[model samples]
Structure formats: C-alpha cells, structure tokens
Target: MVKQTNVKNRKLICDKLLTFQTQLEADYSDKLYEVSRKRYAQIDDLENVHTGFKSAVKREVKSLIPFSDIYKETIKLSFERVDAQYQKVEREYKEIWKEYSDNLSLNWSILAPAVEGMATFCGKVMRVLTSSNEEIDVSKLKSILYLKELNL
Candidate 1:
C-alpha cells in the first residue's frame, strides 16, 4: 500500500509539472511571436523612410545642374545616414534575439531531463500495470496525460 501511495504521489507531481511546462512553453512562444512582429514592423518603417528620402533627394537633384557638387554631397550624406541607422537597428535586433536564445537554452537544459525522467517512469508504470507482452501506445494515453505538447 505504501509503494502504491508513493507511485501515486510521483504521478501527481509529474502531472503538475507537465501542466506548468506546457504553460511556460506557450508563454515563450507568445513572447517570440511578439518580438518577431516588432522587429518586422521596425524594418518596414525603416524601408519606408529610406524610400521616401531617396524620392525627395531625386526631386531636389532635378532642380540642380547635372553633376553639381551640391547634389553629389547630398546623395553621399543621405546614404551614409541611412546606412548607419540600418546597422544600428540590426545590431539591436540581434542582441535582443541572442539574449532570448540564451535564456531558452538554459531553461531547456534544466527542464528536458526532468521531463524525460517522468516520461520514462510513466512508461514503466504502464508496462507493469499491463500484461507483460502488451504493446503500449503512448498516444492513446492523451485522455489521461497532461503533456499535451509532446507527440508521444
């Protein structure tokens, strides 16, 4: 009876942990999506700025004499400014993603082994509870399993 109770306790703990893991995964996914959306929006805004500036420069140059020094200087300065802004944004985006990736790796390292252990324990229980030669299908346990994220 004590052994049975211990098994029950362990199963309960696994269920709770699995639920928590699922929630954490969902939150991480949402954060990733948000970050991607913001980054793309910034890129779109920058592209619009670049296109608008080029158009304005073209119009201004049309009013100047061909190959004028002033037109040449204006084009060079505009290109430099736009290139600097793009590089800065790219650096910031990479830094943000790098930090996120580090955290994700750390979390997975801590979490995956525990999850795998629990899954193995559950599989053993299933084996023992069924006939010796019975073929267990983990997918069929979805009704009783808390790990909705796992394909198994």
Candidate 2:
C-alpha cells in the first residue's frame, strides 16, 4: 500500500511539473511575439520619420529661391521636428529594452533551464532586425537585444 501511495504522489508531482513547463514555454513565446510586433512597429515609425525628414529637406531646398527669415525659421522648425522624432524613437527603444528586461527578471526563477532558449529567441529577433534587407536598420538596437539574449 505504501508503495502504491508513493507512486501516486510521484505521478502527481510529474503532472504538476509538466503543467509548469508548458505554462513557462507559453509565457516566453508570448513575450517573444510581443517584442517582435513592437520592433516592427518601431521600424515603421522610423521609416515614416525618415520619409518626412527627406520631404522637409526637399521643401527647404526648393524654397531657397525665396530665402528669408521666415523660410529660415520654417527650416529650423522642421529640423527641430526631425530631432524630436529621433528622440521619440530613442525613447521607444529604451522602453522596449526595459520591458524585455523586466519580463526576463520576473521569469528568471521559473525559466532557469530555458534561459538559453530565450536568448536564442532574442538573437533571432535581432538578426531579423539587423539584416541588410530589413526595412529598418537596428544595429544600434543590438545592446538591448544582446542583454535580453543573455543566458540567464
């Protein structure tokens, strides 16, 4: 009877462990998806900002014929707008890094064995963003990606 009870308890523990593993995997996968989506959105925003800046530069050049204090002011404002957009992008990158860092910190205990897996996921994401064919350059985004890719 004691042997049967021990077997039953072992089975219960095994089942619980399996459930925990599954949940952990799902959580990590969800995080990866979220990060990928956010990265893509940031890329889109960067493209839009680049396009707008180019257009503003073209406009300024065309208005050189009517160069005046007003035109100069308009150019100055456009430049400032571009600066603001770059700053916003920088802020967003930092936010994403923080989010990933927080999530990893939260799950560290439960995901110790899966640390390498998580790092691989992050590395793949970085590769996708840094690829030459990628629409947006993310070379500067490597630090955040690498940190998240660390084997916890």
lDDT of each: 0.47, 0.47
- What is the per-residue lDDT of model 2 for residues 1-152, given as tens digits with 9 covering 90 to 100? 99999788656544443443343334333323444465334444444545543453435333331435434544455445545655665677779878877777645677776886886788678657753232333222332233223321
Whole-model alpha-carbon lDDT for candidate 2: 0.47
| Candidate 2: segments with Cα more than 4 A from true spot | 1-52, 59-65, 105-152
- Each prediction's number of clashing residue pairs: 0, 0
Q: Model 1's lDDT to the true fold?
A: 0.47
Model 1 lDDT tens row, 1-152? 99999788656645554453344334333323433354224343444444544454345333432435534554565455545655665677679868965776555777888887997787566545531232222222222233333222
Q: After superposition, how far is residue 66 of candidate 2 from its true place, in Å?
A: 2.1
lDDT of 2 at 86: 55
Decoy 1 TM-score against native: 0.33
* Weakest lDDT window of 10 consecutive positions for candidate 1: 131-140
